[model samples]
Target: SRILLQDTSAVPTSPWTHFVMMAGSTLRKVKSRSWKKQRHFRLLEDGMTIWYKSRWAGKGHSTFSVTEVEAVREGHQSEVLLSIAEEFPADLCFTLVFHGRQGNLDLVADSPEEAQAWIQGVRKLIHKVQTMDEKERLDQWVWDWFQKADKNKDGKMNFKEVRKLLKMMNVDMNEDHALHLFTMADKSESGSLEIEQFVHFYKILTQRDEVWKVFQDYSGDGEKLMLEELENFLMMGQQEGERSAQLAQELIDSYEPSESGAMSLDGFQKYLCSQEGSIFKPEQRDLHQDMSQPLSHYFISSSHNTYLLEDQLRGQSSLEAYIQALKRGCRCVEVDCWDGSDGEPIVYHGHTLTSKILFKDVISTVKEYAFKASDFPVILSLENHCGVEQQTIMAEHLSQILGDMLLTTVLDGQVPQQLPSPQELKGKILLKAKKIGGLEDCIDETLTDEVSDEEEANGDAESPSAEDPPAESLTENDKVKPRKSKSKLSKELSDLVLYCKSVHFHGFEQARLHGKCYEMSSFSESKAKRLAKEAGTDFVQYNTRQLSRIYPSGLRTDSSNYNPQDMWNVGCQIVALNFQTAGLEMDLSDGLFRQNGGCGYVLKPDFMRDGNTQFSPEKPEERPDYKPLRLSIQVISGQQLPKVNQKEGSIVDPLVRVEIYGVPQDQAKEETSHINNNGFNPVWNETLNFILHTPELTLVRFVVEDYDKASRNDFIGQFTLPFTCIQAGYRHIHLLSKDGTPIPPSSIFVNISISELT
Candidate 1:
């Protein structure tokens, strides 16, 4: 039969329905937290199973269609099709869609001569599919569908018949999608698809089927289940048969002391509270019954599909409550920290929140909490809500309390020459660049005035935690004018580079820099390169838009994208020792790092940090909300959590909100306890694997649990982690699962080493 191709242009009436049917029976559903995407899809009745993705080493490709073919035969079929297409004559042309962004390919072969050229192009496509192992899996599935469309029991399929067959099979199978599949499949332009064509089409349908199944499973009975339903379901199999009845009676007895014979949800929950049988007990269930523990590895990249949690611990004080919250499994934590003008560090994240309490009181309160600093496992980002001096003072104070658990980060040259602890060098504190308005101009002033006073008085000029610089002193001429504030660009940049250089000079891993600037676009690539060369720094930060301008350009010899006239504009290499870019995008092209010849950008860690901005009333009506000091952190479990303790192929837990700063230390400390479905599992004894990814903390004590294999010799012994930012190496460790797998632990120790790179 002669084939006729037709194109249709309307949204599929039942995309989900059609997708489910096409994916096949095995796949359960297509579930994600992001908006779903739809593209033109084809429904080929041809017996050929289309291969879309690869699976396994060599099943040749996993065929999803009911049709079966020998592995050796399929391999030879693939070869023959590719070889014949190279010389077979065929006509090829593409049709432009009016107002359409994507052009449709139309290969018109009126005679054998033109058909031959078309076949050559087809050969290239076949060869490409053969070379990709993943594509093999896809090809096999497509072939299956083609086999089914061969209604005459013949080995070949024509589009005219295939289209009719798809309509009967409940697939829209319109002309455009069908013709696209056919054109790509028919290498010889004989206007007919041999068995190979069927194979490729089958693969495409199979994947659609799999994804459809997932969507249905997640949709669940066409009803949106409530939280209560989910909770009850989790307790379903916990207590079975007579034992369940006995527990129920016990619960009633505890609450119905007065013998009402009826109980409320609260009463029922309370009365049934036996450690051995309580439904709320962690051992009773996993996080949620429907959500199984993820088996994938760490999430090394960021995307819209990723999940983000909200800050829950808004107001609370009981350290116990905080600990319980942590046990609840949150990946992020925040705490209010203060630098008591006395150069003492206090754990508080706000200016107003701690106004009533002395910094020392905050410290003393933190000491009373049951959990030590080591118990918390998250990157602690601080906001210098307190002035820059206090932030520095607090850093010093924290350096002492945290010891090896702190990580230090300095942008350019803001840090001092010597720090007290080797743990500081380990990667605990970040000497981030705090760009003052017009900070560049303020540098000389900050150095000549602030630095001079501090040096002369050894930073004793003002109380390290002085509240406000006396508002009256801020009136225009008191120091530097607001508009005159400079970038602090050169100093901060140089400080980061110099610090990295100094640390590296000591034969240690180069210390990293946690660079920050509101206007990242202003942070040019040339400046960054110079900083890298001068200071030997690692890790730089950029917002989305800024990164696009600096993404490397591989071949800009004479392209409009770059100026070939300037060598610096062409073949630029933007290396991110440990780079991450966040914020707004100028365009989609900006987000494609690979296209620009650069590694991808990492999403900002959804963690808590201290934030401070002094606001002035420019006008009477411009008054803003007087927000007390506010600080928060992000926590993850198996999804957002950085790779720390994990099985070889298991997924990294999510980043949840386990704790927060600005709250009382006890409250902040308490948030970490209730994680991983209650009583923490001490199976993976591993430290956070990618410390450099978070260049903020100066010292870190990674508390991972090792499955107790009943062996005393479970430790992996001590090792060292050397980074570019810190010259001295931080001690590395493996708190392995008793069996050697990395897992969560009750607690562990980490020391931050901070010193000049050299």
Candidate 2:
């Protein structure tokens, strides 16, 4: 009954669809206020494409598929549309945001109803495209090729045209096999194949023999899989446990083409390509980890210099940088505060040519977006180089702008043995800076104190926030500038710093004896790495009670990042990276924080969470929970990979690189040989092996690169997931662009198997 209601139901049609199909409309295309020109736009008869051209003879027309559009904003929500808001009303404006890096197209209508019709009409079309199943998407891709290959615009394609289409689709097919399939699909004997017939030819051409073999092994006959057979297959083949029966029935109902209790070949294929069939486990996509532990018991996502959008030397600082960082689930951000030439304190690199903005503005932006992505606490790591006067101003702005969200004192008015948990301070922002004495010493009087910057343990550092000079602005003589560690502190600013007090680091023995739970220390990457290597278990014990921050080295003037896995291996809570940079380091950081609902605080493994833990990152095999997992991955094929360089005429020669990042013993990389000249759909059936000593903190990265013997290989796309969240089966790993945005229809299919490494 439920299946009948879902299958044979009538969907009500909207009037906007009729309006878009019948009479075309003329709208003003907006680039800027001065470039608003009249253009005639109409929806194609297929309702899957939109065509637009200027109202002049010289202006050529252009058509774009409905699948290209990502979304439609109903009002002036874009920068371009907002720029020309004085001339156009907000209700009359709409923007079409396209997939990938395509620029948005803004348009204005004469009437509100016309704008409403186009907005709703385009939304309906986008919904239809998004709801298409795997088989329908495959058919659409083939039908689009047929339409492009049929130059005469006829409704049919001849054998010669079909043969040409094969080459265009990156298929090096045999001529005899192509002719045989074409003749079989040409059922009307009209010497040509229609759109439906071409789709049939595609189904036969791309049939999965491996999938058929598995299905036949489980099915009673050879065609369909009943509930019992499907459940059995789910348990044995997909690595599902007691829930396999419910999961199998749900998959059949959701993916089966018809209203039947049994699953067919098409339905099974769709289920295998769905999210359940993806490499990452579905449960890990939500908040499934414990959040009631102390703040030091989790690995927090942190940013090194969150205000810079480019090179740290002379990059432009904007509020958008803070917004972007917070939206990407960065729980901790660094702010370098210096006394401005004006009365207000400003934010920028201390001794560089980087641009500055008002400190209040940064606080305001942080206030607006602090909880946008994650509700857990956000730590504002303040590098204060301001005098007592401007420091008071910075304190006022922080308290006023971040009104109720700031953690002014200890959580719950109690100083516990350990710090508060993320759940205890969900919507709060914690300030990490130099304090006068401690949390309870908030006296209402100014004090003269020696306020030197926390010198890095590297022994040659300039300052804590050594946001060094321009990329190449170092003088030959004074490599290490003189330091003045004396300044005045006001009671107003000092009171705001409760928890997360910045302190200097003595040796490990001194820290173990005197370090308070609320006191934290920042270490340079080189120093932290040396400490981890020298005393791995001690560093892990220190992090069990107090938070430690690891930042990039000062020599990185280009704002490049160092791999954070070494720091994280020692159970460091906040390993900061240049969030503005996109590379392998940031990829590992994002991957580690991507689990636990992406709340930006992933709990440490059990062995690393105990203060008396004897587990050493350098020797993870000594831990009790160190059961190694033998991971075997078969790189099967690539499907619809985007070309590395879209402008070049040559197709890409692609190769796949699978990498594992964890303890030193588990870190490894393997690559497949390059396919000569195909980026569209290349298949390489190669298997790679990895043995993970500590699978709890492991991350697997899949990178696709276009191989080039002439120069360095160009990057195509990459996807990374935590090893514990990986699913075992024949799964598709959806690819993401270099900046971590999805490119539609671009994925890699692989078969994964894992067992206990005895």
List runs of model 1 lying over 4 Å from the truth: 1-314, 317-379, 385-393, 408-758
Q: What TM-score, over all chains together, does every model reach?
A: 0.20, 0.83
For all the candidates, what are their Cα RMSDs to the real structure? 27.0, 6.7
Query: What would the per-residue lDDT of candidate 2 be over residues 198-269, giving only the tens digit for each residue?
Result: 988877877767667778999998989999999998888778879999998899889998887999988997
Best by lDDT: 2
Q: Looking at model 1, which ten-residue stretch has the lowest summed lDDT?
A: 293-302
What C-alpha lDDT, on a 0 to 100 scale, does residue 683 get in candidate 1?
Answer: 20
Per-residue error for 414 in candidate 2, Å, reads 1.7
